[model samples]
Target: MDDLVTLWPSAREASEAEDVPRRVMITGSEGYIGSVLVAKLLDGGFDVVGLDTGYYRAGWLYNDGKDRPRLLARDVRSLCAEDFEGIDAVVHLAELSNDPLGAHDVRNTYEINHRASVAIACNAKLSGVRRFVYTSSCSVYGAAGDDMVNEESTPRPQTAYARCKTLVERDLMRLADVDFSPTFLRNATAFGVSPRMRFDIVLNNLAGLAWTTRRIAMTSDGRPWRPIVHVEDICDAIQATLNAPRGAVAGEIFNVGTDSNNYRVSEIADAVAQVFPESEITFGDTAGDNRSYRVSFEKIRRHLPGFRCAWDVHRGARQLRALFEHVGLTEEMFLAPPYTRLRELRRLVESRQIDSDFRWRCHDFS
Candidate 1:
C-alpha cells in the first residue's frame, strides 16, 4: 500500500494526492480471464499487481516456456491482512471457476468463491482500496422465461457456480457503504483465444471437438439461447471501469456483452462447422428443456456510455482453429489429464503442483 500512497505529491498537495490513479490488484491474475485482463490493464497504463495460486495451470496461455508476468503465487484465502496495502482497487477474478469444478467440492466452492471473496473485499476496503470490480456471470439468470432477459429479470441460479456469483453480486451492493465503489460485471459465457486459453467454453469446446473428433455434440437441443462474448471484450469492459466517472459505473450492476452476440448453440456449431470444414455436427434430443433467452445489452451500452466489445463468436471461432493448429493438438492427443477431468485438481493439490494454501480451500462446501 506504501507504493500507492507514494504516488501522491508532498503533504502540501493534499487534495491532489487524495484521488490517486487506480493501481489494480488482480487476484486470479494468471487464470483464463485474469491473465488477459492483466495484459489489458498493463497496456492501459494502470499499475497492476497480479495474484495467482496456479491451481489449474493448463489454462495459462501466456506461458511460452519462458518469462511470465509479475504475478505473485499466493492463495486468495492466505493473503495476509497486511497484504492489502498499496492497492487502489481490485478486479476479483479468482474462484473455483465452473459448475463441474465447484461440484467437485461444494464446500471448497463456497469457501473459496464466497468466503474468501468476502475476505478480500474486507481487507481491500480496510486498506483503503477504492473501486472493486467483480467479474460475475450471467448464468445466474438461469433458464430465462422470455425472448430476452435484462438486468431487471430475476436471477434463478441452478448451480453452485452461478449461485456463488449471485451471492457476491448481492454482497457487492453493500460494499458501497465502506467507500469501495463496487461494480458487478455479469459477463456472458466467454469463448475465444485469450492470453489464457480456455477450450472449456462452448464455442471453443465445439471447435476442439470438431477439430479432433470431426464431430460436435449438443445436448441442450441446440435451441437454447446463450449470450456469448470473446474474452478480449470482457477484459475491455473491465478496463473501462478503472477510475471511470463514479455515476456511470460505481456500485452498479451491468450485464457485459453485446446484444448482437447471443447465438443459438446450434447456430454457433453450424458456424463453427463452416469455419472448420472437416467437422460433422449432430444435435441432441432435449430441444424443449428451456434454459434459453436472448440478453438485452442496451443497458450497459447506453448507460456505461463508453463501453464496447470486440470479437464476437464468429471471430473467436476462427482464432481457435488457428490456436489448435499451432498447438499441434491432434486426434490422438486426448485433452491433458487435468483438462477434462476437473477432479484432478485434488491430485494436483497432493502433488504440490501449485501452492497448497489454495488446495486447503478446495474441499466440498456443502
Candidate 2:
C-alpha cells in the first residue's frame, strides 16, 4: 500500500521524457488532510518535505520523520527562497481554515491565507520550481442557488475564509508573469479522519453529534447539495498534480473531487444514523451560511482519468465513527468555550501562540 503512493509514470510516459525527479513540498503537513497526504507522497517515492508549525496539536503528525524526506516547523509568514531551495512543486495548504474558524479572527485569516500565500508564490518562482498548487475550497462558490459550477464559475466567496482563499488565488495567478505553473484545486467539502482529528467537518461533526446526543444537528433545512471527498482521495489529487505534465496543469484551475461524493446534508445525517443504527438524525429549518450546489470533478478526472477514488461517504462516516470511539472523545470536546467555539486564529494571535512576523523562510521549491 505504501509503495503505491510514490509511483511515478515511466520516462517514456512523461510526454517530453525528461529526467527531472519530482520533489514536492506540502504545507499544512500536520493538519487533518495533510498528514495523510504526507504518508502517500513518501510511500510513492517522491522526495517530500512537510512544512508545518504543528498547530494541529502533538498527535497530528505522529508519522512524521518516518517516511517524509523532511519536516520543517515554521510559520508561513517566514517563508523565503531558501525554504524551497531544492523543491520541485509546492502544495500550499496552510490557512486559518473554514468559516467558523475564520470568523474567530478575520484579520488573522486574511494575513495567513492571502498575504502569506502570495509570499510563498514569489518564493516558489525565485527558487525555480515549476508546479504550484493552492488548495482552494468549493465554498468559494458561495451560495450556488442551483447552478452546477465548473472552473468557469465566478467565485462568490461568502465568508471571511472563503474570500481569503479567493484573494490568494488571484495573487498566485497574477504572478503568472513569472510563468509559475499554478494549479488551483477548488476542493469539495472534505471529510473523514486523519492523524489530525477535526470534529468540525460535516461528516465528522454529524458522527460526533450522533455519538453523544443520538441526534445530528442540521444547521438549516439541510437540502443543499454539497460535494465531499475523503482525505485519501484528496492526497491522490495532489499526487496527480505533482506528476501531471508541466503544460497540462500550468495556470489552470480544477475542481478536485468525485461526482458520486455529492450528498445533501440531510442525506449525510441519515447515512450516519444508518451506519450507527443507535443514533437519531434531526434537521433544522435552514442552513447557516446559505451555500449549496454540487461541484463537477469531470475536469480533473478527464484530464487525469487514471486517478481513482476509493472511499465513498457512507464507508467514510463509518470509518470516522470507529475512530471517534477509539479516541474516547467526550461531550466536553466541543463544549469548551473557544476551541469548542471554533479555532480562533485571531485569539491565537492575542494568546501570542502565533508569531505572525516570524520571517517566512523557504523550505522546498528549488
Candidate 3:
C-alpha cells in the first residue's frame, strides 16, 4: 500500500494548479447510475470514457436520445494502470450494486466490490489519475434506528455488500496522500428513470407494483428507516466532487442526499400510494429485513456548496409514475431479469453465459 501511494505526485505539489478535470473515466457506465452520469458529464463539456463488463446490457428501458460517450466494454477486475492512462479522474461505480445482490454470493462480493475496487484505485494512483470519486452507500450505517448517523459515526455494516463498501473505503483512504485524492460519496438509496431502469430498488419497485397490480403487498412491517434520492441527484454530487479543489474533497466521506429525504419504509409507501392513487397498500406485522438506517446529509451540504438533492420521494415517485405511463410498462417488463442485477446474474450463470466466478465465457463475449 505504501509503495503504491508513493507512485503519485505529492498532494501539496499537485494542489497548486488543480483545475476542474477535463477528461473523466466512469466505470460501470452502462449500469443504472452510470447510464445517467455519462450524459451528465458529456453535457457539462467533459470528455468522458465509459467502461463496463456488460452484465446488464440486456436491459434498456427507454431511449433518451442523448449522445453517449466512448465506452470500453471491459470488466473492472481485469483493469490495469494502462487503462487509466491520460484519464484525469475516475468515478468508480462497478460492483454488485445492492445488499440483496451482494448476499447472492458473499465471496464474489468481496472479490469484486472490495479487492477489485482497491486494485483499480491503486492502478489509478499509479497512473497519476488524481481525482477518484467512489460511490459508497449509506447502508453502511446498518440498523441504526431513529437517531441519524453521519460520516463520523461508526459504520455497522449488516450485509456482505455494505461490509465491502466500508472495507473499500478503509483501504482507499490509506492510499490518499498529497498526490492521490479519493472522495467517498455515501449515497442514499437511488431511484428514478434511466435507460437502465431498475425495479429492484424501493421507489421504482413500489411504483412498478402499483402500475402492474395496483397494490403494494409488503411482507414486512414497513418500519425501517430508509433514505432515498433521485439517480440524477447522485450524478450532481459526483460532478461537485470532481470540480472541487483537491484539499476540500481528498480522503473525505460525504453522505450524499438531503436530510429531509429520509423516510420510514411506511412513509415511502405512503408517498408511492399518493403518486399511484389506484394502488392499495398492505403490510405484514413482522420486520422481515433488519437493514435499516437514517443518515444525516448535512456535511455534504455544508462542504460541497453545489451539492443538493433536487428530487424528494414524492417527486421521484411521480417521475416513476410518469415513466410507467410513457413506456406503457407492463408486468413482464417490470419483472424482467436484466432490470434486477441478481436475477440477471443468476440467469447468466444458469445459462452458462458467465462462469461461476461471474466472468463471461470467451465465446459469449461479443
111-226 per-residue lDDT for model 1 (tens digits): 88988898888888888888888988888887885568888888988678788998888876777863678888899988886655566678878988888898987666788888
**Tens-digit lDDT track for model 3 on 1-366?**
234323433223433455557789999999999999999988777789999999999999899998999999998999999999999899999999999988889999999999999999999999999889999999999989888899999999999999999999999999999889999999999999999989999888888898899988665688888999999999999987876777879999999999999998889889999988888998867544787799999899878766678999888888888888899999999999999899999999999999999999977346
Better of 1 and 3 by lDDT: 3
Cα RMSD of predicted structure 1: 6.4
How many pairs in model 3 have backbone atoms within 3 A of each other, for residues 3 or more apart or on separate chains, i.e. clashes? 3
The candidate scoring highest on TM-score is 3
Error of 2 at 45 (Å): 0.5
**What are the root-mean-square deviations of the candidates from the true structure over C-alphas?**
6.4, 5.5, 5.6
Please give the CA lDDT of all the candidate structures. 0.75, 0.75, 0.89
Give me the candidate number with maximum lDDT: 3
Model 1 score (lDDT): 0.75
TM-score of each: 0.86, 0.86, 0.94
Candidate 3 lDDT trough over 10 residues, lowest sum: 2-11
What is the RMSD, in Å, between candidate 3 and the native fold over all Cα? Answer: 5.6
lDDT of 3 at 4: 33
Considering TM-score, where higher is better, how would the candidates rank from best to worst? Answer: 3, 2, 1
Q: What are the runs in model 2 whose C-alpha is more than 4 Å off?
A: 1-21, 59-69, 177-179, 333-341, 344-352, 355-366
